[model samples]
Target: MSKLEDLKTAVINGKRKDVKTIVPELLESGADPVEMLEQALIPAMSVVGERFKKNEIFVPEMLVSARAMKEAMKIIEPILIEAGVKPEFKALIGTVEGDLHDIGKNLVATMWKGAGFDVVDLGVNVSPAAFVQAIEEHSPHLVGLSALLTTTMPAMRDTVEKIRGAGHDKVKVLIGGAPVTLEFAREIGADGYASDAASAVDAAREILAS
Candidate 1:
């Protein structure tokens, strides 16, 4: 495989050191940052996500791979910005109120960023009112909620309801986490749900297109 392809595969395998080393090599070898991002980094994360869903990989692997990808991103993001390659969509992401967990949320956010969406991470313990305020301010194409605990699931539902109540139904809502199931997502009035980071990108793309 070419250097870019090698870089991508390394990222998919969660080789943080390789990503850190190879990204700059690719740049020095005259690879376009945009091409590297689209052809390599994005697809690498997509594969990681797929593996996660298929049980070929777990959260620890996914997080490490995402961290590697972010390391590469540190080099390429500025070039993409300079080249005027803005993200195709904006996303607001957060863990719901009463939930302090963030690893899952951060993984999804990184994947979204890799997918070329401008992600506005609301951080952990975000309330319904905060979600509304973010929607009003960012006008994101998608609003993502993550809850790791069964106890915090209600906060996801309440946040969704509050968004609807605030008259921003046009903005799509997405939910995910260890305890969150597709049935629960539907029940909470979410537009979509993904069990892992890769599917989350696909779902976000579809929601934005609709």
Candidate 2:
């Protein structure tokens, strides 16, 4: 395989050191940053997510690979910004109130970033009021709420309600986590539900298309 393909393999294998090394070599060899991102990093993460969903890879593997992808991205992000490669969409993401769990949230955030959305991560234990405030501040096209515990799930509903109540009805709300289900997402009136990161990209695209 070629070096670009090797970069993809490095990310897939979760070789952070190799990913860091390869990115600069690729750049020095006159590879386009946008092409590197689109061709390698995004697709690598998407495959990782698919593996995770299929139980072919577990969370530890996913985390390392996602971390590797992030390593490459840190180098490319600046070049993209400097060259005016502004993300076509913005997504605000957070773990809802009373839920300190963030592994799932962080994974989703990283995958969203990999998918080329400018993600504003509000972090764990985010209150409904805080979600509303973030919506007011960022005006993102998509808002994602993650809750790992059954008890904390209502915070997702309340946040969604408040955002709609606040007259930000157009923005789509995407929900996910270990305990979250498709029926629950629909009952809570969310715009979409994704079981994993790769599907999250698909859901975000579908939501945007609608």
Find the candidate with the highest TM-score and give its number.
2
**Candidate 2 per-residue C-alpha lDDT over 1-210 given as tens digits, one digit per residue, 9 for 90 to 100:** 888899999999999999989999999999999888888988888888788777898878988998898899899989999999978799999999999998878878877876778999999999999999999999899999999899998888898889889999999999999899989889988988988765788888888888
Per-candidate RMSD, Å: 2.7, 2.1
Q: What's the TM-score of each model vs. the native?
A: 0.82, 0.88
Weakest ten-residue segment in model 1 by summed lDDT: 109-118
For candidate 1, write residues 1-210 as lDDT tens digits.
899889989988888898888998989989999888889988888888778778988788887887888889888889888988877788999999999999878888977876767899999999999999999999888999999999999999999999999999899998999999989988989998888765788888777777
Q: Report RMSD for candidate 2.
A: 2.1
After superposition, the stretches of candidate 1 with alpha carbons farther than 4 Å from their true spots are 148-152, 178-184, 196-198
Whole-model lDDT, candidate 1? 0.88
lDDT of 1 at 80: 87
Clash counts for the predictions, in order: 0, 0
Model 2, runs deviating above 4 Å: 196-198
Pairs that collide in candidate 2 are none
